[model samples]
Target: MLSDDELLRYSRQILVQQIDVEGQLRLKQSRALIIGLGGLGSPVALYLAAAGVGELHLADFDTVDLTNLQRQIAHDTQSIGQSKVDSAMARLAAINPQIHLRAHRSALDADSLAAAVAAVDLVLDCSDNFATREAVNAACVAEGKPLVSGAAIRLEGQLSVFDPRRADSPCYHCLYGHGSEAELTCSEAGVVGPLVGLVGSLQALEALKLLAGFGEPLVGRLLLVDALGSRFRELRVKRDPACSVCGSAHG
Candidate 1:
């Protein structure tokens, strides 16, 4: 049940036809896990919190650096040396004091990751690097949870959603083979600040739609953004029958 304060606090969003009282209540009951607190994770965390997700578990092993301020909006000069999860938590708490925030200051191992995935309604893969992305996909597949993955590097950004519970949905490993080893870093490649913000904000939007049972979630499609060219494209993604992570043989 939403408190009178909650109803009033979220009155503006609730006024929308798609998210009236019922959707607002669902938002207040959803639990989401965020796998990173950097560029993409920053806006994802903030919007989810402000939109009234009941519980948010933030996981990140990195600390804020002076360079992060350019794209990581949740951290500021005062939080320069603080842990990313801690810095993000502080900002989220300030945004909506009613929501629950859990901080996981380190990367999760296989067993711990499985446990964390099992505990959440959905998982957001905002982490950088292929290794972590693969690990997150494996855990979500094993636990049959939906995974929202977003990445931004240089002037390019991509977003996708994979629901392991849906047999037809493609997991991240299906789109990018398990053997692929390409790894890119923003520090080395240099990402525009707004690029990540745009992707992260869209990530939050996908999450809200999924949670509230509203518009279509990007279950088997990937959206690509070319910030330099100022254009967007969509690709139809298919599940690989040979996918090692979510294949019949794996099951």
Candidate 2:
């Protein structure tokens, strides 16, 4: 049930035919986990918090750095040395005091990661590294949770949804397989700020749709964003029957 304040606060969203009062209430009852607090995580956190998701689990082990301000919209110059989780928590709480926020300031190991996924209704993998994404995907598959994954680097970005609950949905591992050894970080390859924000925004939108039980999710499809050319392309993806992480589970 939404209080008068909640109903008024999210009036615009609630006004949408697809997300009326019932969807607003559903958003209020959903729990989500956001991995990482960098470029991609910033907008994802902001939108989800503003949209009235009841509980948000913020997981990040890194501290804010000066270089992060270019795209990490959740932090400011004053947060240079603060933990990413703490900084994001402060911002989110200010946005919607009605929502509950859980912090994971330290890096999550296997057991902790699994526990985190189990506690949430869904997860957003905003992590930059391949290892973290792979680990997160495995955990989501094992826990049977839906994962909204996004990535941006060097003017290119991609967003996808992998739901263990959907038979045709492909987990991250199914698409990237072990990933490339030559993968480069934003620091090394460089990225346009808007690229990550765009991807993150879409990830948030997908999450909202899933939570509110509205429009179609990105499940089994990958959206490619080419910032340099301002073009969007979507590629159909299918679950791999032999995927190392999710194959056996689906089978």
User: What does candidate 2's lDDT look like per residue over 20-138, in tens digits?
Assistant: 99999999999999999999999999999999999999999999999999999999999999999999999999999999999999999999999999999999999989999999999
Clashes of each: 0, 0
TM-score of 2: 0.99
Worst 10 residues of 1 by lDDT: 178-187
Q: Which pairs clash in model 1?
A: none
Please list the C-alpha lDDT of all candidates, in the order they appear. Answer: 0.92, 0.95
The per-prediction CA RMSD against the true structure, in angstroms, equals: 1.3, 0.7
Q: For candidate 1, what's the RMSD? A: 1.3
lDDT (tens digit, per residue) of candidate 1 on 27-140: 889999999999999999999999999999999999999999998998999999999988998899999999999878877999989999999999999988899999999999
Full-model lDDT, candidate 1: 0.92
lDDT of 2: 0.95
Error of 1 at 155 (Å): 0.4
